[model samples]
Target: MILVLEKASAWWDYAWLTFKNPSSSFVEITGYYIDRYASVGAFLRIAPNSSGTLGVQTHLLQKGQQYSVYVTIKGTQALEGPFKVQLPAAESEGT
Candidate 1:
């Protein structure tokens, strides 16, 4: 499986990054950030040519900015899951 975190800014960033899987099972991914709004990208698994993730990232989010994530299984197939994203909370008065 391939995982992608995108930061959608008009500025420069890594267009694509590839990962090689040394195992043969499903992978658990966490804390992924897609930071851009318009940029398009995907995670590609070459061995079985199965499962990928595609999304856009953005730097700014408004209240109710609407964030959604979907996964693609076997390239052409899509599966939806329980994905949620929240704005980073402000620092408290005390450390």
Candidate 2:
């Protein structure tokens, strides 16, 4: 079963990180970080050839530019990235 957090809305300041299990076997999530804050779910499980999404907390007041998000897989190497996504500008009230 998949669980989606209601707080994951368009107006959220946090960055959304996507993770995938490359191996044919299932992979366990050891740890992940969004900037400085740790992920809410630790020791999470992912199916083989499956993917999971998590919201990485970010604060614009602290950073003026960009930040990085990384994940550690159990019995495997850690993947790091300064993942970035740009949201489309909201339309005008009248438009």
Candidate 3:
């Protein structure tokens, strides 16, 4: 399951949760930024666990810009999908 976190800023400040398949031995979550220019940012490993809450710091992003985060999960047994979240510039903090 995937959930889009609200009140996110350019720094990536938001809390999100990811579920790992019980049959899977490992799970990895990656984070990226999508700028208004339709540019893809570098992929960073935000979470490297099976199941847990990701407390992201939005400071990773730049001000006056928008971004979207996506994650891909692979289980050892079965079940795989992509999760994504969109961030708007209006939601960013004036820091």
Candidate 4:
């Protein structure tokens, strides 16, 4: 995830998660949650050899939040994650 590239003047902090499927088959990411809340604009489908991304609003941090990513592939029992949700240390602490 990308969180280090933030500026103090920014109103919202950002983080990113990206993935590529190496197989020859198309896949759908049917679920995505961050800190137990569903992420906005999370992907529903990802073409083969293509990538998918999950975004985080790090500006919304609360006492150094705990978060994770989860994915369920379509038409299969394949499960891809519970990946750690990491953000760069804040540029500056704010109230």
Q: Best by lDDT, which number? A: 4
Query: Best by TM-score, which number?
Result: 4
Regions of model 1 farther than 4 Å from truth: 1-23, 26-39, 44-56, 63-66, 89-95
Query: Residue 84 lDDT in model 1?
Result: 44
The CA lDDT at 23 in model 3 is: 32
After TM-score superposition, the amount by which residue 28's alpha carbon in candidate 3 deviates from its true location, in angstroms, is 2.7
TM-score of each: 0.32, 0.53, 0.32, 0.54
Error of 3 at 48 (Å): 12
| lDDT at position 43, candidate 1 | 46
For residue 80, model 4's alpha carbon misses the true position, in angstroms, by: 2.2
Computed on alpha carbons, the lDDT of every model, listed in order, comes to 0.36, 0.51, 0.38, 0.53
Ten consecutive residues with minimal summed lDDT in candidate 1? Answer: 8-17
- Least lDDT summed over 10 consecutive residues: which range in candidate 2? 1-10
Residue-level lDDT of model 1, residues 1-95, one tens digit each, is: 24333332121211122323344655433223443334234443434323433233433544334354443444234343324444333242122
- Worst lDDT run of 10 residues, candidate 4, spans 1-10
Off by over 4 Å in 2: 1-11, 34-41, 60-64, 77-95
Kindly state the number of residue pairs that clash in model 1. Answer: 15
| Tens digits of lDDT, candidate 4, 19-49 | 6766677766655555566545445565666
Query: Per-residue lDDT for 73 in model 4?
Result: 58
The residue-by-residue lDDT of candidate 3 on 45-75, one tens digit each, is 3243334554443444554443444443332
For model 3 the local lDDT of residue 51 reads 43
